[model samples]
Target chain A: MDATVTLKDVAARAGVSVGTASRVLSGHSATSPAARERVRAAATELGYRVNARAQALRSARSHAVGLLVSDVRNPFFADIAHGAEQTALASSYVTLLANANEDTAQQDTYLDVFLTQRVDGIIIAPQGEGRGNLRALEEARVPLVFVDRVVDGFDVPSVTADNAQGVELAVAHLAEQGHTRIGYIGGPPSVSTGRARLSAFLEAVARHHLDDDPALITAGDFRRASGGTAAAKLLAHHRPPTALLAADSLMAVGALAEVRQRGLRIGEDLALVAFDDIEWFGELDPPLTVVAHDARALGATAMRLLLDVIDGGTAESVVLPMRLIPRRSSAARPHTAASHPSV
Target chain B: MDATVTLKDVAARAGVSVGTASRVLSGHSATSPAARERVRAAATELGYRVNARAQALRSARSHAVGLLVSDVRNPFFADIAHGAEQTALASSYVTLLANANEDTAQQDTYLDVFLTQRVDGIIIAPQGEGRGNLRALEEARVPLVFVDRVVDGFDVPSVTADNAQGVELAVAHLAEQGHTRIGYIGGPPSVSTGRARLSAFLEAVARHHLDDDPALITAGDFRRASGGTAAAKLLAHHRPPTALLAADSLMAVGALAEVRQRGLRIGEDLALVAFDDIEWFGELDPPLTVVAHDARALGATAMRLLLDVIDGGTAESVVLPMRLIPRRSSAARPHTAASHPSV
Candidate 1:
């Protein structure tokens, strides 16, 4: 068996006290530069590996971050996580990802586990409607960052796409194409993004001087199935809107299917605009029009902020801009006078 | 500062030798029940942790596993990672995921980093062509489990979906739908899945008494753009195919766009089948026919296998079954001769 080199041996070889060696080797910055260099040299000569667990035990800092997300299966959340991972890795920190699966109980258990593991910080994308677990994370005083959605009065660093602006982009684009009666499909009101997007739709319509009908507004759980269900409700009304705005790409795809089921054509019959420009959206027939968030960039930025906080900076919040890409789906509203042959 | 309790303290309180206390704490079998009970009670009272890192150091075993993947942003890989995370968390092991971006240099660097980190084992889905860096992993005698792809002639465990059977299912389904000339659009042959899928497609077509037309087969790189490129090649041919088989969902989506560009409708003018059921596939105008592999289940199973190996079990391979889901896309192949009326 190879002989294990101890800090004491490094200190003796460097001709420094054990405390000085410890401070220098642990990067505590208490030792003089000359002494630190000698200590480092001696440690290198001895091939000394500071027992990470032992040091963690003494310092009570694991240098690990815990990232909890609603679902790992979702590409949107996954992109953010990748960004976090890249940032964390660059900062010599490890991130542990916990999947909440939108279950409060499971989220709570994972939070407890992470706390026990003594991570330096946490980044959470809360699942549905649970504040208890988030409150616990906040109170832990172990720097936290929230992504995609914001919690009211949480006072933590957060990164989110401009939900209202994104909605406005979609609505204004559709209105420009002469879509008077426009429909909105958003996620559940429980989530911040969902609520903001839905409200924004109404505000944007009013701003654009278009008729805001309560019957045209529908809400689902940000799922394609829910979008299909909501589209059914809106279409069954007295007269369906000429254009539809879905808050997510998945929901947009669902709306597209629902429209086709009614023997309607996208862009031509009913203009469509969805948010979150999912990967396949670009390749779709009459590729979807979208108010898009740079998913990967959003993730990477959140991670960088978390890393900054971990590197001993003050907490900050960042709201990223959204870009509206007009695809074939939102080319022109069919019934609009601009699209009609000489009236 | 909290006073640190030593193992000697626990040993004294339990009225047992330090060796006996160590054995009980390490979960090794002890001679007497009373001694075990005393050690357990004493440990509970003293708040002792088994100190996994210390045990690993003394035993020269790191109890850490590394999961290397091509890309984490893809939902397919993310599913596998989620599974691995669940398995690692349950087994009290740490799993590190490294994304290589399908770059050999990046893969090599990550592998080196894993080695320097002294992980107990590794699970890699190599970029498939690089045996150069793998020699180190193999020489370290680290139990390796390859997931998603296999490196030829490497005596390591691998877990992958049955790609051939999956392709056969798609071909048989298309043939039964009365599609005579089927075009196969596959990913690059460098990948194991892509190669196996293309071969299986040909085999299945031959078994059904169909001619193997070179013009009907085009290779892509498992991406949306590649799918479009492959589709264009097949479509531009003098004798175009009535049905198309895409090796992956992204490619299939590309194919969908290409067909639509030519004023062809899915389930009518062109029959389609795709591998990997991406989220939007079901919500497409006509739900896609897919050869589906549950990525999350694959990741979870691979992690389980790694845990077993780390826990003193021998290395083994796990082959997950693939399923073909028939949807609207493969409902019928339209007679283009009638649709065009001039062909």
Candidate 2:
């Protein structure tokens, strides 16, 4: 669907007058609740794209895009920001990055800042429910594209990694390596990627006929320290998993330290794999095996999507593919074939 | 010094009227060159701190600070940004981060954005000469602080690593290993840290009476790929050095790959020490010895200093100390005493 769909099309589909449809789209309180709902549903069904340039023609163009990241400390997000900013700069636009620091309130604050700064468009690694400033952005008709995660029921385009595929790849690789009981350290369920990957892990393990013990699973807040904490808990179990899968790179780093502290060698005593790939990962003692996601490309693609929206073009959401890169971290031989009870 | 020094005091010291002093300080084009010179010199001498809060009281507070970093992809700056943002958030201020990508033109673009955004203040890890936006920031009386790198002749508060001390520790440790022919991969001389570290390296080599050949020193852009290029040039020499020192962690990571590609064993074939200490360094095969600088503390300190200035509090610039962390990377056995040109 292109930007050819207009308010008249939405009005016709909603069975409302063009004036009422325009009023509802403009967020006018005079509209009835039923009419508002119909107009919104009709707009979504018709794939009616907002003409951001037309909405913004009243003000001079700032040529600035606000990029709100979940966390600046996360190297994955940092790489994404680099890619997005470089792409924006190439198009003569500058990206002003704000770190939500993985907090909803902080995200709201930056959203307000972006609005007041009059940024031409915004690209966010969104957090929390689609309320408050996020809703405000849609109401204000600001051009936006979600980068990593997306909120439910939001009519926003996004460029995100295939989290389910990544989790399945990591799990199948460990199962093939004779690890029947694999410890899974996942992210908080509140985040979309977190929930998707965790669900994928459970499904993949069942497909491989591996242990479904509750003790094998743990969740972290997608940060480094949480990974360490989760690893510690898993290792202290009576029957620890022979292999470990961390949902992200930061958590994996934390897990590596915890494993080393317990005098267990990675790739040997405990096979390990993480979700994201960073350049320095290969420098690790036994290079880290990872489910590789192109974070830079994700950022670049998101910017392109946002620009298309800003230029009155409609674009589809992108789900980038992922692949597994095996290194020494998960390449060590198991003691015997008996470790794989399912096979 | 304190913001107590007023226009009257400056004018009196410079033998000019209060109106003339105000014009010069306000960057009024009507001011004479001599008057601007006298006013600036007098202000510097009196340590006339800008009262950004007072100047900004006329405009509604944005409560947002701009933090311009050299490179977001560099983990060092990433850590610094995290620390600064967390601290800023604690103060009920949000940080807007812009990546210069190690380019001066990019730096200018972001500076303009910050200015137009009406940020309460700015903290920059600066590059290029002390001109353009760097000068505009000073003349505009915007509260500013330098982190990691400082531009010369800018009387801005800064939080920077002790380059001399860091270089001394890394060089002395390597020298004690009886490896006199050490290769140094430094940063571009245009950068402050780069120049300081290179000068320190040259002096230390002279002090230790080691190989002072110009070929022993090479320059990179403080990025990963440049480090690889520099390492390739160094290793392809008529006789490669037994020890190598990369000025920054990114460059060091690149050197690691290059050394490995050349089939050189890091700990056994050549001793290596990097300047910045990152968490993953210890996870490298044989581990890495480093000159440790707390990047988080550097960032946190710079933010605190910037906040103090915004609050009209006088504070001294900080020169943080550095330490040496010895690991297997630099614990290799020397082939013979003949490796020491002086001894």
Candidate 3:
């Protein structure tokens, strides 16, 4: 009836040596069948629950993985968590999800906690450059996988969307609408996704022969308020852009609010496109145009790669493709009839 | 440099007893200052990392709590998780979040995993009656708090919204707009919120002296697809209700899509109201009217309560109030100008 019934108690009840009891309980293949049967029966009779931590120390497996996301409130990350958790459950492994809240310090704190917990593996949508606890985790040689984003010096297997292709699709679609002056709201440069997408956007603009004004590029922290602030600055320019693109969905919503407050229609006055696709984006009056990728698939793939690493198998990094889903947000420009086509 | 440096090794290196080293490392106040200093030096010299599970067994404190939500993808629950994690982090604790995905079997599995992990406490938006792992958790007397929803027989401290008041407010507003027949799309009765809201809707209809046709009430699993199905069923009736109220935000979105497909303008042909407000709800061409509650506050309060229980305090249950935010979706009916006032 005591909660702290130990292996010694089970061993005594089974009339076996402590070493034999432990090996049987830890599922060691070398244990005799008779010893395993007696130890199991004794454990059941005495209601001896195995101390997971102690057992993990002996067996080097906990059957639990840690998933660290940049922000839990972001729908894209939420969808990813759902996919990863479901996949983990199917494999009989529990996922312990932690939110970094887009803060590098918070991400480090969680990485330390995951290490302390001794999870079988970890799948992370990393925040910034791998440093601090991330370095410690790598030094410890824990099974690790990157989801959606990766750190600078880490040679970890990752599941990420093709940022270059996604950016190109958005830019090309906007260019086809005859908008030569395109403004871009990008994420922070500290994050991999932010840097990749920004560089891709610049490359796409040059390839499409659009205006390359320095003032056209603004940055946000991948949050809604930053989108609003960035949008305000761009629209206040001497000659504002005819079209705007955001790096993420939250920022896009913020930009939409800003455009509305300034009495500008989304499709009519300024064309808008967002990087990530979300369910509610389609519900907006003039639904948003988005560079779409499967967030759930990304999460699921990361989980599978982590499991493979845990099983001592090497996994190749996967880069999923992206496509443009043009809605009313980037409809044809009214005056440029020759270059634009109705969508 | 070994990852498995034990307390015995630290004690041996420090020329002290293992008991003294363990007492010092576990922060037992009874340890002498000299012993504490010696153990600290030896631990640092040997690069000793305490196994969290082993320490949890000895100290019976893990500084980690499990939070089980019905669905991680739901913005409402996601907000709750954000609030809870922030509060936990402020207290120098970690939150291990698990998604039940609205399935009782999955909920039980996560609960079992939480117990095995030896979390300091748990906060759950529980599903179904108190059974399986829920009962086992109660028997174990692990510090527990319910958030948003509660089980039938558990006396756990909880933070929940006033579902009755929320439902009554929506129904009264619809009746005031001269909607004699209002359709109700509610959640499954297995959940506490579902039962509370359904009964409240029935009571409000009686109080307002409006039509209470049995055919007007329908239920869903609190999912988007179920909402669409329920909406279709209600709308197909020979005498379809003029106004529709969905129990949750996802269901509201489903109903919105259904209404649009039927070519019925929300504010003109049919009035729609949804429970649970989301950020994007306001961005719709005709913004949704919602029964609003602070989801983040609900999560924060639950974490605070669970922490109290963990500290062996008798925490009181909290019931958060809800209010109606009337928007374009529930604006005055065009033909019933005399009974309705413009919103």
lDDT at A318, model 2: 99
Candidate 3 has which clashing residue pairs, if any?
none
| Best model number under DockQ | 2
Q: Which is the winner by lDDT between candidate 1 and candidate 3?
A: 3
Per residue, candidate 3 scores C-alpha lDDT tens digits across A223-289 of 9989999999988887788889999999999999988888777888788999999877787867899
In order, candidate lDDTs are 0.76, 0.87, 0.87
Docking category for candidate 2?
medium
- Model 3 chain B weakest lDDT span, ten residues long: B334-343
**Model 3 chain A — which ten-residue stretch has the worst lDDT?**
A334-343
Q: Write the per-residue lDDT of candidate 1 for residues A207-299, one digit (tens) a residue.
A: 999978788888877767778888878767666777888888667878888777876677776788999877767666557899989877776
List, for all models, the DockQ compared with the true complex: 0.23, 0.60, 0.55
Clashing pairs in 2: none
Candidate 2: misplaced stretches above 4 Å? Answer: A1-58, A336-343, B1-59, B336-343
User: For candidate 3, what is the lDDT?
Assistant: 0.87
Question: Which scores better on DockQ, 2 or 3?
Answer: 2
